[model samples]
Target: MNIGIIGAGAIAHFLLEKINRHRHENLRISSVFVRNKEKYRLLESAYGVSLYTDLEKFLDSDIDLVVETANIDAVKTLLPSVLKKKDAVLISVGALADEALLTEISDLAHAYKHNVHLPSGAIGGLDLLQNAHALGTVTSVSLTTRKPARSLIEEDIDEAKTVFEGTAMEAIRQFPKNMNVSIVLSLAGIGIEKTSVRLVADPHIDKNMHHVEVIGDFGEATFSITNNPLPENPKTSYLAAMSILGTLERIGQKIRIGG
Candidate 1:
């Protein structure tokens, strides 16, 4: 599997290190695309992969899969074309909040015979949500995300404050980078308008915490995860990067597990 990565940020760096640790002879990084050529020049020598600052050139490379660890804008602009030629693993799941864009990607993938894989970022139990939805019983879905006040509102507060309470779509608009989990939950359990989301600014906690709940005729499900943020980027969960790596590792495997 020849892979192309489309970011040079914290998640991209961490993901690369994990890929190196679990080095697969078949899984190889063929190219990297970053906006800043000088900033990520080290990647060329470190991974022995071709690096390109140009999007067109990067897309022209011999990459079987393009891993989007970049921003939502990058996903919106770059991914549709990539899907025409190869499969993709999208970490910027929040971008799919746009119904038109999501439909466009789905159409392109179906037409191109390519797959777009979405991993459980920062939290889990999404398979349960999808399963419950499959039974036509998933009636309710909600995500309560608690983060350090400093990371949320950019200040330490006296107590935990409910900063935002709205639909998953609004929450994503409000906190584009911080609320990927809300979109992920929405996509799996219900549509965006029906899914509830709450963002908390908590002075009491140091970690990024997510509480997801689902209700249906199949029954109820609850899950909570306190994720440590990546060292280079406090807004991102370390587990999120690991989830992408795990999804990549699962590729080209003979044995399949879980939902």
Candidate 2:
């Protein structure tokens, strides 16, 4: 599997490290795509792979899969081209909250016969949520995400603050990077408009915490996860990068484990 990576941020660096540790002889990194080559000149020199700032040149590379570790806006801009040719793994799943964009991606991927993979990022029980929704109608879904106040903003907050409380769409709009898990649950269960979200900036907690609650005809399900922040980037969870790597490994394996 010849992989092409997008972005040169913390998640991208973490993913490259994980891939190197896997030592998968068949899986090779073909190239890297970034907006400004000058900014990541050191990364380009260190990796020894072809670095491209041009979209057309990157798309023309011999890449079987594209791993996107960039922001939601970058995903919105670059994903369509990748979806038209090769399969892609998107870490910034929040971009799919836009129904029109999601529809466009779906249509393009369908036209090209390519798959877009969304990993269970940072949180868990997504497989169960998807299966439950498939079997029966899910009445309600809510996500409560608690993270360090510093992660949300640079200014210090002494007490736990309700940073955002609204529909998934609003939360995504308010906190694009911090509340991606809410959008993930929304995609799996209801949608951005229907799925409720509560974002809290807690001064007491050092780690990022997510608590999801779902109610349906099937039953009631609740999941809570406390994730340590990535050392490279305090705004992101370490588990977020691991989840993508896990999905990549599963793609190469023969036996299926989850739904």
Candidate 3:
């Protein structure tokens, strides 16, 4: 599968290295789209892919899939155009918290016969949550995320503190970069407004911790995951980048583990 990446950040760099190491998978990065050509000029020779500043030229490349490792602004601006040409893998799942933008992308994907894949970022038990929701038995879903103070805020704190508590939609609006897992959980089990979220900044822990609880007619399930932040980026979890690679591998699989 030929892939086009939309950013040149830490996740994009990690993905390029992994894909280069696993060239036998037949996954080739055909091109990259970025705003500043000079800033990412080194990636061209390192990854052996063309970089285009123009959206039209980038979309016109020989790419069957587009992986957006960019931020919410890129998703809001560039993703619709990408879906019109090829399928997309969105890493910024928090952007979908906007109901209007979500509907717009959904309509565009439907109109173009394209798939918008959202990777389960930084957490697990999504398959169970989805299955429970499929049976229409899921009553409530809640997520509590705890991260190091540096990841959550610029100020150094001596003690752990609860930063924010609200619905998934509100959480996303407040902490756009850190609350993507809450949005992903909300999408898998319930609507954003119906899903509750809590964010905490802890000085005691160095890892990013997520606690998910789901209740339903079937039973109650609670999941706790502690993830190390990416080496280059503190706001992103290493597991989240691995999940993107997993999602990409699943694309060409003959039999998918989870539908």
Candidate 4:
């Protein structure tokens, strides 16, 4: 597998390390997209892969599978044509909040015989949720994210306050970089509007916590996840990077359990 990565951010860096650990002899990250030339050099040295600042150059390479970490803008640019040639695995799941865009991509993938892969980034239970949705009506889905007040909001001279409390649609509209889990839940169980979302900044909590509750014909399902934050980027969780690794392995396997 000649893999290509679209960003050199924390998740990308961490995933590359794990991929090396997995050590599929033929599977190598052939190319990476980075904006800065210095960053290209730095990442090239670290990962032993060729780096590109240009999107077209990276896309034209021998990459068979591409993992996009650069978010919506990158998805809009890269996915359109990539779906024409090969499949793309997306980390920026929040981009699908736009119904038109999601439909467009979905249509393209179906037409091209390729696919868009969505991983359980920070939280889990998506398999159970989706399957349950088939068996029973998922009447309501709600997500509550609690974290250190400082971690939830911006830093550097900002007063403390709980910023976001609204629907999943609104959260996706407001926070593109964060709130991917909300978008994922919305897609899996229900539409974005009906899926309830709450964002909190509690000064007391030591770790970033995510709580999910689903009410349906079958009954209720509740889950809580305490995620360790990534060292380089506090906004992303360490579990998220691990999830990506697990997802990658699942895709290549013969019989993926509960995919």
User: Top model by TM-score, which number?
Assistant: 3
TM-score (C-alpha) between model 2 and the true structure: 0.93
Model 3 residue pairs with clashes: none
The best candidate by lDDT is: 3
TM-score of each: 0.95, 0.93, 0.96, 0.91
Poorest 10 consecutive residues of model 4 by lDDT? 152-161
- Using lDDT as the yardstick, the better of models 2 and 3 is 3
Report backbone clashes per prediction: 0, 0, 0, 0
Clashing pairs in 4: none
Model 1: CA > 4 A from native:
none
Q: On residues 1-259, what C-alpha lDDT tens digit does candidate 2 reach at each position?
A: 8788999888888876666444556666668899888888776556556788987788788888999988898889999988887899999999988889999999999999999989989999999889889965899999999988877867788999998899999988888777789888888888889999999989998898899999998899998999987888876788998898888878888999977
The regions of model 4 sitting more than 4 angstroms off are 21-26, 154-162
- Of candidate 1, the 10-residue stretch with the lowest lDDT total is 17-26
Q: Report the candidate with higher lDDT, 1 versus 4.
A: 1
Model 1 clashing residue pairs (backbone): none
Residue range 90-166, candidate 4, lDDT tens digits:
88888888888899998999998997888888898888789879965889999998777776565533333567888
Q: Whole-model Cα lDDT per candidate?
A: 0.88, 0.86, 0.91, 0.81
Question: What are the per-model C-alpha RMSD values against the true structure?
Answer: 1.5, 1.7, 1.3, 2.6
**RMSD score of candidate 2 (Å):** 1.7
